[model samples]
Target: YGDLSKPYGTGNPVKARCPPNNVVWYTLESYLPTLVYGCIVDAWVTNGKCPYACKFRYESNPEPGPFISAVNEVITRGRKIEKDRVVMYRNLLVERALERLKEIYWQWLKLSNEDGPSLASLWSTGTVSEIPTLKPFCSLVAEKKQLDKASRTLVLGNGMVRREWHNKAKLAKNFALLPNLESGDLNPHFAKTALMDLVEDAINYLEWVIVWPTVVQAVRSTPDGQSHLDPVIVLDRS
Candidate 1:
């Protein structure tokens, strides 16, 4: 019915024209080679997926070079040094403030008891001249000193450090008022008034030591790290 040597598309009428939507026809000799080439192309594309592979490399890789590790070490050491300096200066300020508080309390106690016991005590003790020597209130002083030491040791800075010192000083000043209270040996009304006056002084000292330094530090923009090393606050972080 057709020329035997002629291909389907050339001369034969048995082959059908391919539909545009569902064409599946192929040349018999070309099909295998096309499939093979397609698989090879897909494999090549998949293998070359990471074009920027160097940029995403890990730091901890076995062959990673030298400079990264050295820089990291320097940064770590610098941070430690800065932290230590901050701690040192904070402690020094706290100690000085505490010592000032102690001196004030001692002076207040001594001034409160100038005249000794009243005449009413003559009946109970016999001789008024035999009054016991003031014991210096050493135990109370020691307790305050211990607390001061503890506060100094605590690592604090910025506003928090200043606030803590102010609070502690206030408490010490309040405690100093104990001798003047009615419950204490001092005359009730007079002692209370004197205590109130001393409390005001305590408040003043706290402002002087804690608030003033903080203001200076703020004005200067002192760094928490190196601020401790310098007696005066310096603003530069470096």
Candidate 2:
């Protein structure tokens, strides 16, 4: 993600690369999702069976807390230096893997709701060993948004609000579940929406989450505005 934080220096001045990924972007982003999610889509349409593990583990028998914390802090510091591009380049593959994992998670959520599972459990954080039997799935609650048919527009925060946006907000009502089986192959649309969500998450993390807080600290540390910290500029999301 940080690799994408800057305008690529070598590209033809118009567009930036798709945030360099170590695991070939074509295979990681385009191919794997199509293959894995394609199978899930096929199963949902036919046999009504989806396979997924409950809660995933980041590491098995993890390191001591103090050592882990120290290393993470050091990694964050390393990212501040110009020479840290190599580290960012390597972790880019990890970032892509994580995103694909999240897609699998959402697919599991879609399967979990086959025959009226508890609504509260939809967003609940716990995981169990028992997997549910999948059925021809359909989300009665999910709906389509047509930009042309929008009856009202509202603005919130720094962004405009519309039906599609509204649908996204209300999406939690169904725990971000996909549309019904009748809708047919909503995986493509779901993948696109997931990518947009990931982009927004990245923007918020860098700008509001990290940059603004650091700026506040810099201003406080130097009353006369003579701090040596570099100015951080966040480019608009592509």
Candidate 3:
């Protein structure tokens, strides 16, 4: 967590982000709305210095002003695959939902007689801004049920299934937690390993979904014509 009151190079309110996120600075993060963060403040450090790169001042409140509670996931562009135009549409949604959530949090603080701004405000400018939508990342439930809930939430938040790719089924499929293939037939010792393999497969599936439309392949391939690494065209999600 860091001070949310100040704007950094890309209009990100979190001072902890830009300096450490240099790799995406020029590519994925050039869009200001997509660069905003979802900060989860630790209580002890909230009253102490900023969590990692402690700013000299604001020691009394590491995360100060307007923002109190936020989902612990960063609203970054690094994870998704969308064309720049699609990203622009998604960014508008993100900005709207983001502003609404922050406003709700700030208002709850005020109505309960806590100390905060009397008005709802955005961290970037301390004023009402656009809203955005996304799945809430944390939940306490059965694993399968949790993934389903997150999937539904993400699809609804995206607001682009019909208008753009029209791949709602594909999106839902990616969100699914795949079941093991005849795990009971395997030895007991393989249970954990099988589960890990499923997890890895799920992540790889997601990667494929994101990168398939416009994945960048290295010009130089191995002798057998296999890629040696993961590389993407720099402008895929700009």
Strongest candidate by TM-score: 2
Pairs clashing within candidate 1: 221-235
Taking the tens digit of each residue's C-alpha lDDT, what string does model 1 give over 1-238?
Answer: 1111222234222347642221111211123223323332222222222222443434424332222222233345542234454344334333333333233333332332455533222111112112221111112222455435331211110011122233343345454432321213222322233233333343334335434546787857966555655666568988
Taken over the whole model, the C-alpha lDDT of each candidate is 0.29, 0.32, 0.29
Q: Pick out the ten consecutive residues of candidate 1 with the lowest summed lDDT.
A: 152-161
Model 1, CA-based lDDT: 0.29
lDDT for 30 (candidate 1):
27
Query: Against the true structure, candidate 3 has what lDDT?
Result: 0.29
Compared with the true structure, what per-residue lDDT tens digits does model 2 show for residues 65-179?
2222323444577433233542452244224433343344344444345464332122211111011210101111112242123221111100111223224433555424533
- In angstroms, the error of model 1 at 115 is 8.1
The TM-scores of all predictions, comma-separated, are 0.17, 0.25, 0.17
Model 1 regions lying over 4 Å from their true place: 1-81, 113-238
1-238, model 3: which lDDT tens digit per residue? Answer: 1111122244333455544333222212122222222222122123322233444566446453211111111123435434563344333333333333232233332332344322121222211112212113112112456546442222111220121112122233331321211323222222223233422443345445545535533343344434555454556675
Cα error, candidate 1, residue 131 (Å): 22
Better of 2 and 3 by lDDT: 2
